[model samples]
Every structure is written in structure tokens, then in C-alpha cells.
Target: MSQAGAKRKLQLSELEELRNDAYASARIYKARTKVFHDKHIVRKSIEPGNKVWLFNSKLKLFPGKLRSRWNSPYQVQTVTPHGAITIFDPKKGKTLQVNGQRLKQYIKDSVPTEGVESVTLADPIYST
Candidate 1:
């Protein structure tokens, strides 16, 4: 009976050691995955008065092969250091705050034809 009890004690200790090793393996895997995810993240910087396009992820549920998923340009109202930004929609006269990562700078092309000038990024210049 004493020998059988000793064997049970040894098996319990081995099981505990196996559990500890599994816990350590899970921790190491989590750390490595976090590092990999952080490395691929792209940082976006925006300033007030800049025009940006907002990504519209809600359109994914619908089927539109040629339709764009990004919304129209919105003017930046304010930017925060914690990657949050406030934007204003001129058409709706409404303001919205969103994550800076979801916004991308909008560049408009200016083509001048028939003595009329196009819109510029900084300011508009009229032709006489």
C-alpha cells in the first residue's frame, strides 16, 4: 500500500509540471503574436483643415463589385495625440470623431481649361 501511494504522489507532481510548461508556452506565443501585429501597423498623421477620406466598412455586407468602400472627403476639425480625430462634413454640416487610422489624406486634381482654374489643395485661385 505504501508503494502504491508513492507512485500516485510522483504522477501528481509530473502532471503539475506539465501544466506549468503549457502555461509558459501559451504566454510566449501571445507575446510573439503581439510583436508581429504591432510591427505591421501603419501610423497615420493628420492635421486640422486637411481633407481625408473615411473608410466605410459597413458596405462589406452588401454586394457591389465596382463600388468604392470609402466615403467622400471630410475636413479635419481636430486631432488628438491618442490617434483620435474629429472631422466635419460640409454637405451635412455635421461633425464626427473617429480613429485617425481609419482616415486617409485626400488629394484632388486641378485641371485648368477654357480660362477656368481648378481647385487647389491649400486654397482656391480664381481666374479672371
Candidate 2:
């Protein structure tokens, strides 16, 4: 009977040890995932007077597959401390504040064409 009690105690201790190890492994896995998620997060910055496009996430009943989800470019008026931006609409003359994550810098298509290099050929010498 004493031998049986000893064996049971040993089994209980091993079970406790396994439970502790499992908890530790879970903690380590959670920390690793947090680090990975933080690493992949993108940081965006906007300055005053910068034009940016806003993401429109409003759901429609019939969503178009090829339609662009971004809105027109808005001029930035000010940047708040907690990722909030105050933007101005030039056409409507209205201003509003929104999260910076919804905004991306606007790139215009009209690039300067004045500095293109041109090739010039010298006039051929007159034949005698």
C-alpha cells in the first residue's frame, strides 16, 4: 500500500511540472507573436500643406470590383498628437479631422517636361 501511495505522489508532481511548462510555453508564444505583429505595423506621417488621399471604407450593397476605394486628395491643415489630421477640401472649402492611417500622400501625374535633353545635329558641309 505504501508503494502505491509513493507512485501516485510521483505522478502528481510530474503532472504539475508539465502544467507549469505548458504555461511558460504559452507565455513565450504570446510574446513572440506580439513582437512580430508590432514589427509589421506601418507608420505614416503627414505635414501641413501636404496633399493626401483618404481611404473610404463605407460599405455599399453592391460593391464594384474595379472601383477605386480611395477618395480625392485633401490638403492637410494640421496634424494632431495622436495620429489625427485636419484636412481641407479645396473644391468645397471645408475642413475636417480624420485618422492619419486613412490618408496617403497624393502623387500628381503632371511632371515637369522642361529639362528633357535634346539632340542636335551639325549641318553637313556643302559638297563641292
Candidate 3:
């Protein structure tokens, strides 16, 4: 009976050791994954007077895949050291503070030319 009890204690100790090893392995895996994810992150350079688009992440009910999720042409007002950004909405005539991660640079399209050229088609006669 004493020998059987000793064997049971040994088995419990081995099980505890296996659990500790699994926890250590999980920690190492998480650390490596975090390093890999942070390395691939692209940092955006945002400054005052730059135009930016705001990501509309609040639409949870009816999220349309074809519709654009970004709201555009918000002029940058100020940038805080902690990634907080202030943008001016010209149409709303107000300024709003948002996170830098939700903002992207907005590039304006080129202006269309006013000059128009008219093309006339000539009738072609085919003889059999």
C-alpha cells in the first residue's frame, strides 16, 4: 500500500511539471508572435494641414461591403504625442479628436480640363 501511494505522488509531481512546461511554451510563443506582429506594422506620418480620411468603425448594424467605410477630406489640426489626432471637418464646420490609427492620408484627385474637342464621323459608301 505504501509503494502504491509513493507511485501516485510521483505521478502527480510529473503532471505538475508537464503543466509548467506547457505554460512556459505558451509564453514564449506569445512573445515571438508579438515581436513579429509589431515588426510588420506600418507607421503613418501625419502632420498639421494634411488631409486625412477617418475610418467609420461605428457601423455595426448594416455594414455594406460595397460601400466605402472611410470618411474623407478631414484636415489635420493637431497631433498629440500619444497618437491622438485632431481633425477639422469642413462640411460640418467643426473639429474632432480621433485616434491616429483610424485616420489615413487623403489624396485629392486632379482637376478636370474644361476644353472639349468635337469629333465628326464621315459616312462610308460600300459598292458591291
Candidate 4:
């Protein structure tokens, strides 16, 4: 006897079980994240008091005014082992905390030399 045109593929439930097993067998695991606001350099170590500026993502800086942009400058107040960074804002003279993924270090070229860059954050405390 010969078995021809048999359905060989696993069912959806079987596939799901295999997928779960994959998740369980993995010794080390991390989430897959996309690099958008800032470049993510692998194997790079970040220390405290390293001095980083937050990139303002909502405001685009003009001659005398700040336009729509994203990310803002925030100093690194603290860095946890899990990569959580506590940032301090000089504009409001307050301190806030955020995750590493939520923040992007401000490059010198991104900021204007003359006058204040102009802080246009929606809230004093950064929510990330």
C-alpha cells in the first residue's frame, strides 16, 4: 500500500504548540526593536554622567522659533542595568526618567550654537 497526496503539514494547533516550545527552549531572549530616533550601536557601554542631550522630535527649529520636531535634550541622570535612563531637564529645572529606547542623544550639529534651542515639550515630566 502507498500513501499518496496525504496532508503532511502540521495543523494550526500543532504549529502553535511548536511556537510555544520555541519560546520555552530559548536560553536568552530579547525583544526586537527598530532604530528610529537614534542609532543603536551594539556592544556599546553607557555610563552615568556621560552627558547626553535629548532630541526634540516634535519641534523643528527656525530662525527665532522652534518648528515641529521630535525628541528633546535630556541629561542622563541615571542609568539602570536594564538600560533605563533617568533624565533631567534644565528648561523646567526638573528631573525625569525614561527608557533607553525612548531617548536619543542629541548631536552637536542638531542644536544651534546661538541662543537657546528653545524647549517645546508638552509636559514638564517626560512620559516614556
Better of 3 and 4 by TM-score: 3
Candidate 1 TM-score, true structure as reference: 0.74
lDDT of 3 by residue, 1-128 (tens): 99999999999999999999999999999999999999998789999999999999986568787888888689999999989999999999999999999999998777665775767788987999
lDDT of 4 at 18: 90
- Tens-digit lDDT string for candidate 1 (69-126): 8899999999999989999999999999999888999989766567886766897768
After TM-score superposition, the amount by which residue 89's alpha carbon in candidate 3 deviates from its true location, in angstroms, is: 1.2
Q: Which digits, one per residue and each the tens of the lDDT, describe model 4 over residues 60-83?
A: 445335443444566677888877
Question: What is the full ranking by TM-score, best candidate first?
Answer: 1, 3, 2, 4
Ranking by lDDT: 1, 3, 2, 4
Comparing 1 with 2 on TM-score, the higher-scoring candidate is 1
* Most TM-score-accurate candidate: 1
Q: TM-score of every model? A: 0.74, 0.60, 0.67, 0.40
lDDT of each: 0.93, 0.91, 0.92, 0.61
Model 3: what TM-score? Answer: 0.67
Per-residue CA lDDT of candidate 2, range 1-128, in tens? 99999999999999999999999999999999999998997888689999999888783555599778788999999998889999999989999899998899998989778998887898878988
Count clashing pairs, candidate 2: 0
